[model samples]
Each structure stands twice: as structure tokens, then as C-alpha cells.
Target: MAILKQYKKSDGTTAWFYKLYMGKDPITGKERRTTRRGFKTKKEACLDLARLQLEIESKGLNNNSVRTYRELYNLWMSQHTLNIRNTTEQRVRNYFTNQILPSF
Candidate 1:
């Protein structure tokens, strides 16, 4: 479910926002909700809310898929090495390959 409302901005202008019920946390068993604000008009807020609802319906809440340790390490390394020097990247890779990957 979603609730849409209008509010007065600091400049005395009206804006729209929506509070959406996004189901519960699978692990924690607690409710989840999301609020989007600062829309210029109610139509804009409703459009975004519809899009979000459609996305949740199509993809469902828990989107993660199981991955092996090696796959996870490779994915992490790809991002972790992007801004680091080549030597630092190699050192991190070596630590994972020799010490971490072996244990896992």
C-alpha cells in the first residue's frame, strides 16, 4: 500500500511525497517502508510510486541470488581494484588467493 500527501516547503511552496509499505524483512521479521519526497507535484509523486511498485512486483523484495566464494571474491576484486594502484591490487589479490580463498 502507498500513501500520498502534500506538504508545505520551507519557501511556502507545496510539494508531494509518498510513503510506501515495502513488506517485511525476511531475516528480521520487521516491516519495511520507503518514503520519497520533494516532488514538485502530486502527479510526479504518483508516477514514481507506480514505477517503484511495478519494480517491486516484478523483481520481488529479496533480489540477491546465491553465489560461490570464488564468484564473490572476483566481484569484490573488480570493484576494489578500480581506484587502487596495480601493486596494491596485486597485493590484495595475493592475500585473498593465498590466505582467504584457501580457508573458505
Candidate 2:
């Protein structure tokens, strides 16, 4: 579901904003949220929300989001390592290689 808000921008123009619930994150199993800001009209926001709903229904909560767990894990690790410390990243890499990858 999505909720709409009418907010005044820094430039003093009123715009529509919406927060959409995009199901769970594949790696975290936590709620994933997507927000869009600065729509010119409420109707436009409504239309976009409708489109998202149709996509969710036609595909699934994940919306054909990813194909496999291994592929997903690889993609996740690639992005996750960029912001973390080197030692922590290496430890995670080792754990995945030694303990996790074998199970897959």
C-alpha cells in the first residue's frame, strides 16, 4: 500500500509525495519502501501508484525481482562491500566462502 502527502517544497511550491511499500528486501527480509517526491498533481501520484499495484499483481510481491539465491547473494555482496571497512568486508567474504557458499 502507498500513502500520499501534500508538502511544501523549499522553493515554496506544493507537491505530492508518496511512500510505497515494496515488500521485503531479499537479503534482509525487512520491509522495503520506495518514495517518490515532487509530483505536480495528486492525480499523477495516484496513477503511478496504480501502475505499481498492477505490476505487483501481475508478477508477485518480488515482481520477478531476482532469479536465484546465489545470484542475489552475489549482487548483494557486491554493493555491500563498497561502504564497509576492508577488514570487515574480508571477514564477510571469508565467511561466505567457507561456511555459506558450500551449503549452496
Candidate 3:
């Protein structure tokens, strides 16, 4: 399906909003539904939707409380490791442990 659906933004600009059905909310005990909107094109809207889906599946986008920076750093460290040297990795780890972890 073509991802772009057009809608009017609050600023009166033409925009595309993607509508996806997210499953029900667990805590509020209410049926949950939301829309990701205000993109300028269908491609943008679809890409946004895909990102939202990924974040939701990854437990990074909690509806109740925002994720702490430490949690995000750990998540990033788990998923991404490129050609960086061991020293770089250690430095990153140390930074996270000392700076980010203590704040949250």
C-alpha cells in the first residue's frame, strides 16, 4: 500500500499522516490506538511508522515512563558495534558507567 495519506496540519500546511493500529494498552486497561502524522510525504510517513514500530518492539518506547539514558546507552551498545577499536569500546563503556548510568 502507498504509505502516504494526506491531511491538513495545524499550521495549514499540507501533510501526510500515517494511521496504524497499535494493540491495546496493558496498564490503563483501555483500548489503545494512535496516529503518526504531519509528514510531508507518504514515504516519510511510512518511514516514521516503521521507526515507531521498531521502537515499540524494542521496549524503548514505553507509554508509561520515559526510558532513562543509561537504558538507552545499553540498548545502543548491544545493537551496534562497528569497526571501532577495543579502546574505543572500553571508553564508551566507561563513559556510560560513570556518567550516564548514575544520573538515571
Candidate 4:
């Protein structure tokens, strides 16, 4: 869904803005939203919002993959272990392998 609103700019002029719901994050389960401002008129905001909706409808939000817990864990560990010490990294790997992977 999209919502349109008008607000006074710093120059004391009325401008239009829009708020759009993009959907949820697959990994975090959080609602995703985007806000665009500084449109000159409500029609301009509505046009931009319609274009964005068309793009999203055509592109489908880019969430086509279904990843398992192990895949997600490996992906996380690849980036997360970069700055950590080898011992700490090993501890984290062990914790995930022993305590986390089994439950999932």
C-alpha cells in the first residue's frame, strides 16, 4: 500500500511525499517501508509511487530463493568471522554446530 501526504518544506512551501510498503524481510521477518519526499505536487508523488509499484510488480521484490538455516549460517559466518580471532571464530562455529543446527 502507498500513502500520500503534503507537508511544509523549509522554504515554507507545501510539498508532497509518499510512504510505500515494500513487504517483509525474509531473514528478519520485519516490515519494509520506503518514504519519498520533496515532490512538487500530489500528482507528482502519485505518479512516482505508481511507477515504483509497477517496478515492484514486474520485478517481484527479488526474493525468489528459499534458503535453509545451514545455508544462512554459512553465509553469516563467512562475513562475520573476518575480523574475529581464530579461537573466537571457532567457538562461534562450535556453538552453532552443536547447539543451534541440531534444533533447527
- Expressed as tens digits, the lDDT of each residue in 40-102 for candidate 2 is 999999998888878877876664556877788889999998899999999998998889988
Model 3: worst 10 consecutive residues (lDDT sum): 59-68
Query: How many clashes does each candidate structure show, in the order listed?
Result: 0, 0, 1, 0
lDDT value, residue 21 of candidate 4: 99
Model 2 RMSD in Å is 5.8
Segments of candidate 3 deviating more than 4 angstroms: 1-4, 8-13, 60-63, 66-104
> lDDT, candidate 2, residue 87?
97
- Tens digits of per-residue lDDT, candidate 1, 1-104, equal 99999999989999999999999878778998999999998899999999999998898877766478998888888898889999999999889999999998
lDDT of each: 0.91, 0.86, 0.71, 0.90
Model 2 C-alpha lDDT versus the unseen true structure: 0.86
Over all chains combined, what TM-score does candidate 4 have? Answer: 0.56
Q: What's model 3's TM-score?
A: 0.47
Q: Name the regions of candidate 1 deviating beyond 4 angstroms.
A: 4-17, 37-44
Write the number of the candidate with greater lDDT, choosing between 1 and 3. Answer: 1
| Cα lDDT over the full model 3 | 0.71
Worst 10 residues of 2 by lDDT: 57-66
How far off is model 4, as Cα RMSD?
A: 6.3
lDDT digits (tens) for residues 43-96 of candidate 4 = 999999999999888876665453799988988899999889999999999999
Best by TM-score: 1
